[model samples]
Target: MNKKQWQGWGPDEQAEQHYLVQPRALAGGGDVRHVSAFLRASGWRDKSKKDGPLLMESPDRTVRVAYDPCILPGGWTIHGRAGDATVEWSAHLGRQTPVEIVAGLTDALTRPRSAHAPNVWAPLQEQNWHTRFADQNYTATSPDGAAWMQYRQDADGAAMWWTGAKDEQGNGWTAHFTPNTPMHLVQAFSTELAGPDPVMRPRGRVPHSAQIRTWSVSVKPSQLSAWQQARITAARAATWARTSARSTRPRTTARPYNPAGGARTRH
Candidate 1:
């Protein structure tokens, strides 16, 4: 829909418009819209209005996920807070970061975790990334060193951090899980980071353009996961229902229409 038409649309219709667009993917990953939808399904409440940052927060408001396309480098930031409120963890996903990758971290937050902490580095190590210790911190680097993860413990606290550089200038994405953030959640993010599948992004929006392979065609709705497709269906229904209701309202109203405002007059 054009800007004017979209502005006149109700939230449901506006959302359907987004769902209907077959977004192109870059080598880094899927659309952030999928991540937004995932958070909503996981009990997060949408706090932003239409066409603004996709901001959502947990029931307790301890966790938040914000996606703003206008943001440079990183367009998505997911955060969580610990009990005292002094410590919070965050993941800044670059615009090209795949939806599945971000969803991996968010999905982990919603599930129950065992007492034991999963090996945060195991996933990357298995992918043949190099690992080493330096200055009391454990660090792992991708074969090319462009991507790295580190775990540091100091007098202050322990934290996990990861960064993927898109260029030598250091423009890219970063994630930091501060002390008290669950290790399982970090591990889940690492696992998705290590997946062998190539993420999709639109050709024009890709970061580290020269470093990854390109696809001639964008991903179609048919290629989306069952969960994603289901969300699209729901959005479609919402938009249709709104349209249907509006169309029937005029016929059902007994009062004469007020031409000045298009409102109905009381009998």
Candidate 2:
């Protein structure tokens, strides 16, 4: 049969295609709870259609958030649209899904109406040190190959040294150390390259009686790269300003709030 004739005669095929394309209904999942909570807190009104996909409308009705639970593997497909921008994504209920729908809807509803007004700032853009560290790739390793470190300077001129090592269980531990001075960074690199070896304790009362073997680490003057020297220089000029301020701040005792719209101070 020709294509048109075959399509006209196939009721089962049409039904199958419709079901495959439609969003499946989700009974219970993390997405439902999170989305529901977000909607209620954000003042979004539910305008879902009967026996249709779940739908939420922003308070001003400028944005719409839709979820179809029929999408498999990923529990649901969330689609959000505001003005000329539209975003759609699918993720399983338990997974760390990019639920940008919440942000988009919130922005659309609360944003300033004026075109000249400044845009709303997003807190996610201000990533912490840990987040920045996770994005870095360590290009250098210690001489013993047990430790790795990365150096990064942020756009705001903040700099940090990230060091990490793996434990016996293959789990990793990391630390951020701010160099007190340029010499401090030099000493850190030197120690990593040629640090002292572990010494055994004397078994007898006379420590001098026991013979201990020792080895020296040799590093040529040319071995220190120019980049390393630059880092050392920067470290020397850098001070732990935050640490100093925190240490010098006076401690205060917090008091309970008074219903009279005033806070009671103990000190």
Candidate 3:
């Protein structure tokens, strides 16, 4: 579609149009704001400098989220540390990976810990992805064969769990979660990736383009889906609440929020 047509299309129409042609074309940078807003609402602080990578830290200062658009690959980084500060865990979302999917990771991060161990492979299974098991390793492949999640029980470091996605032309990206990274976070990303929901993106903004294939469709903004509408509303409300709380706080720029008496350092 032309610029005018693309600009006039609503969220749902854009999503439908994209999904019709390239179902794997996720809305990469589109949901970064939503992710940041959610983090702020969850009591994370924006510690980034002007025009630099957006750096946000959890209230307890044990976790940090970084989004650096200038980086070519692996621009999104989430790191968490143990209480003793000797061990660290991390997840990296490549620049081409959808921010919508990354938001799932952040959501899982802030959620209250569950008593039962999470089944990271369940989401893909629910979506009907083909799952294969080996001695101690498992791999889940998407229904369309465009994406995959692999787990190596015997491996350590980044190879423990890997997620990858590709377009029709073979252009692709991958995300890595360290061995020590929480399993729920991986499950959250798996759920988002496997879910049938479409991530909206303008034609040319898609992360990777097929060599010879092109597609576009347009519709009114009123066609937005109910779930997307609710998400937008909730994100905006959370942002407003966080901003209001910040504005009403006492003006003590010298000292930051630290409920614990010790120094709060980023991992």
Scored by TM-score, the top model is: 3
lDDT of 3 by residue, 1-267 (tens): 787677645443433444223444243456577688777766679999998899999878989999987877647899998547878999888877777778888876765667888888898899899999886778999887888898876644325788878767767668888877877778888888787766666555656554223356653455544545666567557657867887999986686667878778986
Question: Candidate 2 residues 151-246, lDDT tens each?
Answer: 666767576554444423433334343432122222223232222333211122111211223223332223323434553343333324434676
How would you encode candidate 1's per-residue C-alpha lDDT over 1-267 as one tens digit per residue? 687675534443322211211111224555667777755665668999887788888767888888887866647777887658767777776765667667778766655576786888999999898999987788887775566778877766655565443435554556566545667877888787667666544445555544455445534333445557686566456546756776877655585445875756456
Error of 1 at 16 (Å): 20
What is the clash count for each candidate, in the order shown?
Answer: 8, 4, 0
Candidate 2's displacement at residue 80, Å, is 5.6
Question: What order do you get sorting by lDDT, best first?
Answer: 3, 1, 2
- Give the Cα error of residue 98 in candidate 3, in Å: 0.7
- On a 0 to 100 scale, what is the lDDT of residue 146 in model 2? 40
Model 1 residue 131 distance off true place after TM-score fit, in angstroms:
0.2
Better of 1 and 2 by TM-score: 1
Question: What clash pairs does model 3 have?
Answer: none
lDDT (Cα, 0-100) at 87 in candidate 1: 79
